[model samples]
Target: MVSAFAITRFASGLISGTLVDKFGERAVFSSGVFMVALFTFLAGLSQSYEQLLFFRAAGGLGSSMFSVAAGSVILRSVDDANRGRAQSVYQGSFLLGGIAGPAIGGLLSVISLRAPFFVYSGLLLCSGMVAFFFLKGDKIGKEDKNADISEHTTVREALAMKPYRIALVLSFIGAWVFFGLRASILPIFVTEELNSTTAVVGYGLALSAVVQGVILLKAGRYSDEKGRRAASIIGAQVVLLGVLLLTFSVNFWMFLLSMAVLGFGGAFISITPASIVGDVIKGKGGKVIAIFQMAGDAGMMVGPIIIGAVSDLFSYRAAFGMSAAIFVIALVLVYQIPETRNVEGPQVKNLRPLDEDL
Candidate 1:
């Protein structure tokens, strides 16, 4: 059952991104969360381990489905003028969720494990309502004769683009560095080195989210005007520095401070990649967003396993040390990659009657 959870999660992300293009974000995002709430509630009533396992996998599917749809909504709804900031707020909402989910879950558990299920349902229902009203998509424009909408690229075509190819690899590294350490192995470092408790861990993580959210809000605006590459390069270097600092710091207060620095690095996660890929795609918003997300999931899967194994052989410090190396590689990659804004926007011209392609 434990293994099934991981298996389902990885698979779900891949499919979710693709599906978003066809359905549009509103229906896709709303229904995905609704499904999870329903299935999870059913899981609570499960009498056997088999039933619970099925529900767990179902929930994973629901979660990724939501990711795919919501990303598309944000990408398409906001114009180029405000995309970075809009997405920053969209992502910051997740920081809010990250805060509420565990706090409410732990609180509800005091009353009953089942109590959290009801809370999850309510939160999702409210979120779905907002999206249903505010989220808009020009799905029909993709089919319009006069719009000059470009045809969607196949996965192969997306991969063949040199800049996009680099974006994919960097995205993987970003997701790996940001998320991989949180679950199976890195928490050990937090507890042992910091000697903190449940409340402390919760607060520490929340602090990161809060700090990162603010930084992202400001950074997103800069990315839009100055260029996304600058934001990413700065963020990557901070993360690398944070990782290095984590290795050397022994004091509890120092540990807390370093986590904030790590949070500073986390600010670039969504804004950087989205801006980069968005620049490359120009008009094909949904497809490029999907491609960017796929790279993130790839990183999430690969980074943890490798880091965890390294930790087993060496130490958490060593694990983070390796992550530092990866971060350096990310910095190098990001630095070398061309700034999307620096490139000219595609030229639009009506084809002449004499032109053979016409």
Candidate 2:
């Protein structure tokens, strides 16, 4: 089941941005949200494992579309100075949903196995409608369609820029540790290493989500007003500290403290990459956004397998240490990228034509 979702996400991530470029952010984003809602509802109705997997895969594809198109719209709509803050708000909404969904699902599960899925489907559809109506001026209007398409930068052109490359690397590393290991390995670490209960794990995650929500507001403003490099470096170092603390944690309290630190790091890490891309792109950057999303998705898919292997071969401490090492590497890369906040570059000009090759 996990593999089906992961594989589909990775695959969809590659093309979703192109779809955004060809159609429009409003269309693609709304459609993706609607697809997710529809497929999730279908999944709930499935009686067989095969049918469930199919629906889950479809949901993954929908997620890919939603992420890429939403990111493109957010980046393009905001000015250079406010891009960081804009991304923060977008990311915060997702985190808020993550926090709410599990609690709602848990409650609904008591009524029936499929009740939560049906309810969530309705919620997603409502979100889609909101996106369709509220995300104004993102679609290339009929009068400007040809000119907009001509002005948009292709994936190849985006790759030639240094900031995009740096952002991609940071995103891949961030997703690997924050989404992959945190979701899959942390619970095991709490249970086996700290001799804690699932309730403790749940509380720790809930606490982290709350902290992340609060800190993201400050982090986004800091990145916009200060500099992306500085904010990202701080974020990576903080995450490394959290990983180090988690590596040595022996008690439930220590584990909870580490979760708080990790949450703080997540505040900076989650939105920085997308904002950086916004810094580098001139206009609708569908292909570049798609590639960036794909890198993060790939990391999420791969991180668990690597962490699990490390835990099996050595120990859970070793797995945690490996994650810390990855953060340190990301920190070094963050330092190498030039500061993008409030700085104008060639990429800030009108979008260029597509490279003939791609």
Candidate 3:
């Protein structure tokens, strides 16, 4: 049942970028968040598994649209110097919600299992209203409100850019290891390998989120002020070290420490790639952002099943070690990619040449 949501979300991610380009960001973002609110309300009212599945998938669809459009809007709104900060704030808000929502939902569940969904629906609706009214009516850097989509760069052209491709690859590996494998399998690893209680595992996960949130603002600033390249390289190395530590950790404290380190690394990874893409793509970022997001979604979809198979075949340690190897690959990719933060406005034009037919 959960798989249905993941699958649909993945599919939505693939096409949502195009939709963002065709429709403006404000319209798409507002509509998407509203859809999420509506579907979540429906989900809470669902009487059967089938109805639940349908609503959940719909919610995923809305979520994909919201993510792409929101990112595009952020990139469009900010100058290059503040792009990192903008993305950091956007991602930080998400992390804040992740940390808070579960706690609130747990409390709501005590009242009724369906209560969280309904409350979340209301919250999403409120957010949608805020987006509709607060987001400036003008397109990102443009004077004309009704410019044709054909004036912007196409999806094909965005993917062809070297820096964009590198960012996309890193997003995939990061998602595969962080969201897919570590998030799903780490608790099991803690219980099985470290002989820890589920409560301890919960604490460790929460600790990571707290640490990630604390560092997100600084990390984003570093990417902007220092350089996107520096942030990516340091983040990849830290994540690799953390994953390696987890692989060899024999006790709870060691595992907890590793999660803390990973929290910082995750903050770096979350902020820099989008910052890099935003630097290179000046106009509508729908296609490029969508492709980057799609890669991450693909990783999220595929990583756990494959890593779980590896764990079954050998051991959990081997599975974690495999993840460390992925971080290593990400490090190499980040290293090879050029620094995009300092690219000038003229460079942006040259980077993504306009496709008249687009």
Write candidate 3's Cα lDDT for 1-358 as tens digits. Answer: 6667778777888577877877778778888899999999999999998999899988888988988888888776777778888888998888888888999999999999999999999999999998888877446322334454555667787777888888888888888888866667888999988999999898888888899999999998888888899999889989888889889999999999999999989999988888888877756768778777788888888888878888999999999998888778898888888888764532334222357326
Off by over 4 Å in 1: 1-6, 137-149, 194-199, 282-288, 342-358
Question: Best by lDDT, which number?
Answer: 2
Give the residue spans of candidate 2 off by over 4 A. Answer: 138-143, 148-150, 343-358
Q: Model 3: runs farther than 4 Å from truth?
A: 140-151, 343-358
How close is every model to the real structure, measured as TM-score?
0.86, 0.93, 0.92
**What TM-score would you give candidate 2 relative to the actual structure?**
0.93
* Residue-level lDDT tens digits of model 1 in 127-176: 77776676654541223344344445555666677667777877888778
Cα lDDT, all candidates:
0.70, 0.84, 0.82
Q: Which candidate is the best by TM-score?
A: 2
Candidate number with the higher lDDT (1 or 3): 3
Worst 10 residues of 2 by lDDT: 138-147
Candidate 1 lDDT trough over 10 residues, lowest sum: 344-353
Candidate rank order under TM-score? 2, 3, 1
Cα displacement (Å) at residue 328, model 3: 1.3
lDDT of 3 at 266: 91
